[model samples]
Target: MTHQESLYGKTPDQLAALCGELGMPRFAARQIARWLYVRHTEDPLRMTDIAAAHRQRLAEWFSPALSAPERVTESADGTKKYLFRTLEGHYVESAYIPDGERATLCVSSQAGCRMGCRFCATGRQGLQQSLTAAEILNQAVSLPERDKLTNLVFMGMGEPLDNTDEVLRALEIITAEWGFGWSPTRITLSTAGVVPELRRFLDATKVHLAVSLHNPFHEERMEIMPVERAWPIAEVAAILREYDFTHQRRVSFEYIVMSGLNDSPRHIRELTRLLNGIKCRINLIRFHRIPDSPYFSPGDEAMVRFRDALTARGIQTTIRASRGEDIQAACGLLSTRLKGGI
Candidate 1:
């Protein structure tokens, strides 16, 4: 049996090529795009604009490639975590966080992560599989509050730059005119500094970037995040210096504050020195404790002191509010382990 492809993630150009192969009119591609993206309908039969025979032909070889979440857990704060099962029989998660006037959905790029950050739950599961553009977009498209979403972040389960191609494809579909047509400013892709793909991502899109910079010293960062050994934080900072983030496109570093581990004055001084030239903000995240993890969140005063110290050094900084902790949907807490297949 031949495998069927889903039309959900294909770009207008890609769909046009498919139309040529199928001998359908070129205009049908845009119609299909409107159906899948604007109308949020994946069923070809409901695409009345397309001829009945052409719709039948599409159905024969293609599936909508959309699936509703298998399970959803809501937090006391109203944040919801959606569990999605991939076509590959693996599970991934997406978090929907609604602030006063802004709603952000944290979507996953891969089922599990291979970066092996000691403090992250997703890293402990090891790499299961990289999600396709379809699977990645499904998190936002199939969302219950899809229309209300104000921003999207690739910060859920995996390192986005680790799966650059599919992530970029999803980014393209997200911001393209024939697709979701969202402003690049409304999207942010977080990475653990996969250097090569970082360069590619910078060149390809105008979306905001968030780098995981939990530690300042190279040796110390290596102790917690093994990616430091491959792509040092120093080198990542240097690469970032080559780009321009002073305008609409912005870059920010994600720092998870641990009690006695990384929130010391020495770390703060080094962080100031490391980020000297780059015009970026530092987001201080409270570390969410995982089972048997030695790391712990610092006191509120300590976190504020760390943020103020960084702010005093000229880099703008703020403490990121922790959300969905009870549901394990906060930063560094997302994992599919209890949902079964590792």
Candidate 2:
């Protein structure tokens, strides 16, 4: 028997096409969108707007296509890490962080990462599988605090640009009028400058962008992030400079401040020179040390000095707070240990 199609994460246009195949009217797509996203219904039978016969047909051939987090761990600081199992039976993690009135969810785009950044734990698992649009959206759709989430960040488990298509689809459903209808400004997709796809992401969506620039110098960055060899950080900066981010659309650089590695005056001067013309902020994140990792977190004084130095150079810089550290929810700590045959 053929497997039924999942209705979750499909765009309105895609749903319209599905409706055509199901012998339903085009308007049925919007109705389904309203039920699936607006109403957050997980069962076809509960869609009261659809006729009984149509609902029956839906139950037979279409599924609501949502998966709840298999495991959740809450940190002492109120950050929560949700472990989700993908269709491929591999696992990924999503982190929900609450800060007063603002809350953000860090969602994954792939089961595991392939970028192999030295400082990242997820990369150790290599590539298990690329997650579907439904899987990417499921993290947010199935969230207990979905209503309280003010922002979403694609900075969890994988290189978003590497899994560009599915990430793009999920983004469309997130910001589209017929879907969740979230503002593009509230979403940020971080990448280690996967140049070609990064350019496509800039052209395709108005959502904010964050470049992972741990080191300002070329050689040093390549040591940690192999992607730098393919798409140099300078080239990424050049491409970003071409885009207009003067208004609501913002672009920021994520700099994980490693104690003595990239927190020096020389790196700051080079960073200022590299991002000279680009209108973006620098978010200095403290490196969360992983097992067998050579990198160490910068002291609070060093982090503050780094932030102050960048600010003095006319770049808006802020030290991002470390959250969920006790639960291994900080940067570069998300992994299912899938490579360990778990």
Candidate 3:
């Protein structure tokens, strides 16, 4: 059975090409874009502006192909974890977090992660497959609160930079004028510093960036995140220094503080030395304990003290509030729970 291509993630240009190939009027492309994005309508028949004779053919050749979430777990803090099944039958999770006036959707870029970060559950499952741009965009387009979503963070499941081509394609559709037209500032891509791809991303888009720099020292970071050995945090910082993040686009270092591990003043000193002269903020994240994990989250007082130490050094820092801990929806907790079985 050959699967029909999904039109939900296609940009206006691609749709225009499809129209040209199908012998349909070029104007039909914009109509389809309006139906898919502005009107949020997926059914070709419901695209009333399109010619009646072409609607059936359009539906036959392409499908909206938005897969509904297989399961939804809501947390007490108004955070919802949505498990979506990829076309390949593997599962990935996206978290929708609502904080007062702000609502952010954390999206996944792949089925399982290949980065192999020790603290990450997704990394534990290993790499299954990469999601197409359609699969990635479907998570947002099919959301119940899609209209209310204020921000999108590529911080779930996999290293987005590893899937650079599809991730960039999705970003283009998300922010293009004929697509969703959302501001690039509202989207942030987080990566464990795949240097070349990170450089490519920085050159291509102005979306905010968050680099996983859990430890300042190379050897210490390599202990948990193996990516450190390939592209050292120092080199990542150097690459970032070449760009100008002092404007609207922002860059931040994600430091997941582990108890008695990287919460000392020495780490702060090294961090200050490493990130010196870079116009960026540091986000201190509390480590969520996984099963049989060797690390533990630091106490609130300890976190506050670390934040104060960095702030006193003229660096802007914030202790990110941990959410959905009960449902395992926080950082590094998203996984399929299936191993070799499927």
Best by TM-score: 1
Clash pairs for candidate 2:
none
lDDT (Cα, 0-100) at 158 in candidate 1: 92
Candidate with maximal lDDT = 1
Per-prediction TM-score: 0.97, 0.96, 0.95
Candidate 2 structure, TM-score to reference: 0.96
As a TM-score, model 3 comes out at 0.95
**Cα lDDT of model 3 by residue, 1-342, tens digit:** 134687777778888898888789988999998888777787888888889888877878775578889889999888999999887788889999998889999999999999999988888888888999988988998888888999999999999999998899999988988778999999999999999898899999989999999999999999999999999999999998999989999999999999988989999999999999899999999998888789998889999999999999989999999899889899989988663254
- For model 1, residues 1-342, the per-residue Cα lDDT tens digits are 133688899888888998988889988999999999899888888899999999998888787688999999999999999999999899999999999999999999999999999999999989999999999999999888999999999999999998998999999999999889999999999999998888999999999999999999999999999999999999999999999998999999999998888988899899999998898999999999999999889889889898998888898999999999999999999999766646
lDDT of 2: 0.90
Model 3 ranges with Cα > 4 A deviation = 339-341
lDDT of 2 by residue, 66-168 (tens): 8899989999999999998877678889999999999999999987788999999898878888988889999998888888999999999999999999999
In terms of lDDT, the poorest run of 10 residues in model 2 is 1-10
* Backbone clashes under 3 angstroms, per model: 0, 0, 0
Residue 29, model 3: lDDT of 90
> Which residue pairs show collisions in model 3?
none
- The lDDT per prediction is 0.93, 0.90, 0.90
> Which residue pairs come into collision in candidate 1?
none
